[model samples]
Target: MATPILAQPDVDSGLRPVPVTNRNGVLEILRMRRDPFSFADEKRLRFGEVSGMNALGIRMVTCSGPEAANEILMNKDRAFANAPAWSYFIGPFFNRGVMLLDFDEHRHHRHILQQAFTPKVLKGYMDEMQPMIAERMTRFPTGKVLMLSEFKQLTLDVALEVFLGLELPKPEADRLNKAFIETVRAGVAFVRKPVPGGRWWKGVRSRKILEDFFYEHIPAKRAEQTPDLFSVLCHAESDDGDRFTDEDVVNHMIFVLMAAHDTSTITMSQMAYHMAKHPEWQQRAREESLALGEHLTYDDLASMEAIDLIMKESLRMCPPVPAQPRMAIKDTQVQGFFIPKGTMVVVPQMANHRRRDIFSHPDMFDPERFSADRAEDKAHRMAWMPFGGGVHKCIGLYFGQMEIKTIMHHLLRGYEWSVPADYVMPMDYSALPVPKDKLPVTMRRR
Candidate 1:
């Protein structure tokens, strides 16, 4: 019988190996779930300095600085791959979507996905989105407290209709929302199984329900050729004459819906929080939006500079996707350490964005950091990557920016809002970072 040979632990000087004395991985998993950022923070503090070569049971390296993140993400041979871990977490649902594909397959899918995000397409999307924004804003209760959970729901509704041309009924939306929430929760679940009553089980069920719903609509949409994301995808063809199969369309549709809705909803809620905290900024945004008038054209969206700045700053403070995970495809060296193949490399956006060396008063929310004169984000091109960088950077960046700006333009112009002085922002970093309490605030007409 041969004894299992553990790799030599490469702890840096003055740093100790994270004690894995406890047999069950439950405590570590719980820490990861309860407060992921804090867990990372603790590791950094305790390890006089930590090395990616030797971190925990996973044999992982976590990079927090801008330079290190850039190296890992921008590598040309595609030395790093997203498939390993992404397949572990999101694969069951989003299998073969652009994000999960790598190399040539990734490039091929990206080309097709790019067509749906053309400037002309986005202009049309804005046309459909404005009325939805205006209608949802009109429904907000004045002088009464409202939970941003409701706001997230409204944005999800808009995202579904605008992106997929599906107007989800209230009951169906509610059920889907629960399923989505559970699916996100399951991403970090300790016990990764489809056993009864487990998060994974619920998520598996949720994915099926969504897949079934979307799959049914593809044929009808293909026949009609409606002018929406679904219709475009069904009809879209690659340069080689390749087209998405019905399953491909369904998976991509689910991916787009989650990407567009979840991130935008969190970002909108954060923007609203900032607005409530800073009445002057909120007022300025409102004034700017009002100047653009009630009926906002695509051209009008470009002129909402102040609103853009506010949203950018809010995202800087609380990015929707706080961390990105990649896997080492071959043994590689990063930051002077040898990271073995199969190691998980985490480039945490939240941690990197908070580096004082990159931004003055990194903790403070200041949109001026992005101003032409300061251009603090230019300190390092990769320093301000909220939507990620490299070939895998968000394909929907332009569309997302347009959707968020459009929503802000309408809401700010039509309403006044405030967060209670005691309001606290609680973050859950399980999947996308979102406010734990859903950001309740009071609203009234300006």
Candidate 2:
């Protein structure tokens, strides 16, 4: 009988093997789930760029640093697939999302999705968001509050209005928000089955809430033209005449809304934390926002250089999606390592973002490192890829950035927030890196 390649326990000629200490894949998986950034950093320091483990009987290869990231993400040979790998973890919930499609199909879906995010469309989204942001800011709680929680609700509301064109009452809105939360948190469940009462179970149940709503509204959206993305997508078609089906619209909306709202929440809350820890930077950013007045335009966002720098640094320190995964569709070598077919290849985004060789004083919260004189991110094209890179890069990147900046502009003008000088955000690494405590800050009206 032929031996399975990964079970051979020997490194192929010119191909590096997983460290001998990494024999227990279950332990490795647990350690990674507990502290992914630490696990990746330790592996890179001890094993260099490429490493792997046979976790729960699956051969998983993990790579660190921008060079490894470039090879896998670039995927010039089309030798790796995004859908199969992502489907294993998040596919049941976010099935058929742009992030889950690959090759020609991915290109096709992306082409159609692009029409909904054109500069003009994005400008419309911004205009829609401005008044909503202002009205919502009027309700922001004062004094000590859980910042991550606040930001989460803020971004979700923005997503519901701008992306879905829904204006539900408080209770209905809250119900949908709860469903989305369950749906997202369920993706990282260690248990994969629909066991009753499990995370996966709840996720499956909540997915119906979102699906039924979108499916019900598709007809109306298709019949009318509105500024909201839901309406635009219904009427949007590729130049080649390809249009999204009802299923495609629902899948893309569920996935895109999750990506937009959740990532923005993490980025905004972390930026606030970074500012609290370093008030001088906060003051600098606030000054820029103040100069722009009560409400700022999307184009005006770029002129607030300090806010942009702070936002970039925050994303660098803690990207919303810390790691991206791909599976080898066929036997492939990424930077001299032989990746066998079916091996799950993982890209460690945060580990590379914090590599000392890549960013000097990588642990510090110095936004100036990204300034013109330094440009540390220029060290490598993929060094600070918070939104990722390649054709599979985030399709809503600009709109998401615009939304985050708009929210920041309002928060800066409406309130002043802080935490203890020596405090640090103790983060949860289970799904996304969120503060375990939900991040508390002493927020006061400015």
Taking the tens digit of each residue's C-alpha lDDT, what string does model 2 give over 1-446? 32134423235466643433435777787888787767877777667677777775467887778888899999999899999998887888888999999988999998999998999899899899999998899889998899988998898889889998888788877878888888888977777789999999999998888899899999999998889989888888888787899999999998998889889999998899998999998899888888888877878967988988998999998899988899999877878777878889888887778888888888899899989999999998889999888989999889988988898888888899999878889988788889999999999998
Q: lDDT of each prediction vs. the true structure?
A: 0.76, 0.86
Off by over 4 Å in 1: 1-42, 45-57
RMSD of 2: 2.6
Q: What would the TM-scores of all predictions be?
A: 0.91, 0.96
Q: Give the top-scoring candidate (TM-score).
A: 2
Error of 1 at 259 (Å): 1.0
Runs of candidate 2 with Cα error greater than 4 angstroms are 1-23
- The residue-level lDDT of candidate 1 at 145 comes to 54
